[model samples]
Target: MAEQPLLDVEQVSKSYGPRKALDGVSLQVGRGEFVALLGPNGAGKSTLFQLLSGLFVADGGSIRIGGLDLRTHMTAALARLGVVFQQPTLDLDLGVAANLRYHARLHGLGGRHARERIDAELARLGLAERAQEPARALSGGNRRKVELARALVHQPEVLLMDEATVGLDFASRRQLLDDVHALVASRGVGVLWASHLVDEAEGADRVVVLHLGHVLFTGTPAELVAHCGAADLAAAFLQLTAGGGRHAA
Candidate 1:
């Protein structure tokens, strides 16, 4: 039998009053694989992220992380997830090390071990020298890097990034992508990256195009273009989502 994927969502559904946010959404991310969740604003990406992060309960379907059911084994399933939200979650008043230290404590890492991990992540992100500086003092790109570092302090097996490059410039966005790609290659960390940017999804192992709360397509970027008979991913995406109607919240 084939090994189970590290992250799996099957027939997941969610709704807010009369509006359905997600309808039978399903996808999988294998170990070290990068799957991009491509969609427009209000395309249910945020809703799915909320469910995956345990902030919102799914009305139906199943989510498995590392073979643990998210609903039945919430703690175990959550332990395997690392998330970087689109909005920055850091306290600007706190020093970089202090922020990371708090995250470490939350994950039950403290004292020497926590320090070691913090040092290692900061060094990996080239932010070791700025450890003592307040978070507000850092550049946007570096702050995002800190957030990414914070998310991985617990050494989760899978990473969920919800439009993590939203406010970043071209260089910063590319750097963040490269950094996450390296993590996948070197640490075998599975990633489910949600974004509306076609360029961001270009290098993904697979792309799941979501429109109007449904998955319109799932395949490699090149395949999506070819399947749509378009010139490139951007054109393909435009053609696929055209007249699909405004995304449902």
Candidate 2:
């Protein structure tokens, strides 16, 4: 039998006035899986992330984290998840360690325990050397690392990364992607990294393609490539998402 999926979204739909942000989108990610969500701008990838992370409620359908329904068990569902939004959220005035401690505090950790956890997470993300530096002083890559460390302090079972590498250089982007993939492999964490970058999606355990507010396809990278008969991921993605009810390979 197949293992239970860490995340399951069924017939999820969301709209804003006349705009349909997501339309009947469904997906699954198994434990220790790194799933990349790919689509062009306005493809609804970020909208899906917002719905999953409780930033917004879907107009229809269900979202489950570890079999816990998000709509009905909001707190429990959120407790099992960590999210790194596209925007930089750290307080520039505060030191890295202080920012982490603040995050732990939000999750209800206190006293020495929170301090120890903060220190450990910083070290894990290679931010220990600059733990005392203000967030504004860190390089873009290091700041991103701090954001990731803060997200992992709670040891969440699911991680949602929305355009986390939007402005990163090639090396920084590759490093961040590798670190997140490693986390999923080593800790049985399920990750949904939303991006339009085809290269970043190539190595994912699974890929879910979205276009015009609808899910166009969901399968392994090789399966997608085969289906499109494309030389590379970008070509495959373009072919698959170009039309409604289409097959290219």
Candidate 3:
């Protein structure tokens, strides 16, 4: 039998007053797979992310992580998930290593085990040399790496990134993408990366396009390009969501 998806959102819906932020959104992220959530701003991408990562509850419908219902088994379900939000949530005054250690502690890890995991994570992120440097001293890319490492200390099976490379340079963005792909491939982790950048979605195993709070399409990058007769992801996205005028991707 095929492996079960690590993350599943079924007919999940949320609203802000009268505005429907998410209209019965459904998605799945299988083990070791990288899926991209592409949509323009205000298309409900972040709202969906919030619901999936347990930051906020969906007004309607269910969300499951590794078959555990988020509402009924929140602690158990959330334990297997890692989230990197759009903005950095690190303590700039603390060193990279210290920041990671703090995160591990917050996740219920303690004592020598936490120290070991923190050290391993910093080394894994290639920040061992800069581990002692204050986070405020690191470059934008390195800072982002620290944030990612912080999220991984618990070895979560599902990674949810919401515009993780928003302010990164082209090289940094590419590096982060490669790292994310490697994480899924080598660690058997599933990733749900939300971005408006078409280039970022190029190599995703599957792509889900959202528009006006609804999923417009869900397929491979090649399929979208082929179906829309477009040369690239950006073109395909535009063709599929052009009723409202120009879009980010």
- Give each prediction's root-mean-square deviation over alpha carbons: 2.7, 1.7, 2.7
lDDT (Cα, 0-100) at 36 in candidate 2 = 95
Candidate 2 lDDT over 1-249, as tens digits, reads 097788999999999999988889889988899999998898998889889999899999999998899999998989888889899999999998898888888888889988888888888777788999999999898889889989998888999999999889999999999999889878989999999999999889989988988888888899898878898788999888777662321
* lDDT of every predicted structure (CA atoms): 0.92, 0.89, 0.89
lDDT of 1 by residue, 1-249 (tens): 167999999999999999999999988899989999999898899999999988899999999999999999998898889999988999999999999999999888999999999999999999999999999999999999999999999999989999999899999999999999999999999999999998999899999988888988888888899888899999988888885743221
- Rank order by lDDT, top first? 1, 3, 2
Runs of candidate 1 exceeding 4 Å displacement: 245-249
The superposed Cα distance between candidate 1 and the true structure at residue 26, in angstroms, equals 0.1
After superposition, candidate 3 runs with Cα above 4 Å error: 244-249
What lDDT would candidate 3 get against the real structure? 0.89
lDDT of 3 by residue, 157-234 (tens): 999999999999999999989989989889989999999998899999999998888888888999889878898889
**Which residue pairs of candidate 3 clash?**
none
Error of 2 at 22 (Å): 0.7
What TM-score would each prediction reach against the true structure? Answer: 0.96, 0.96, 0.95
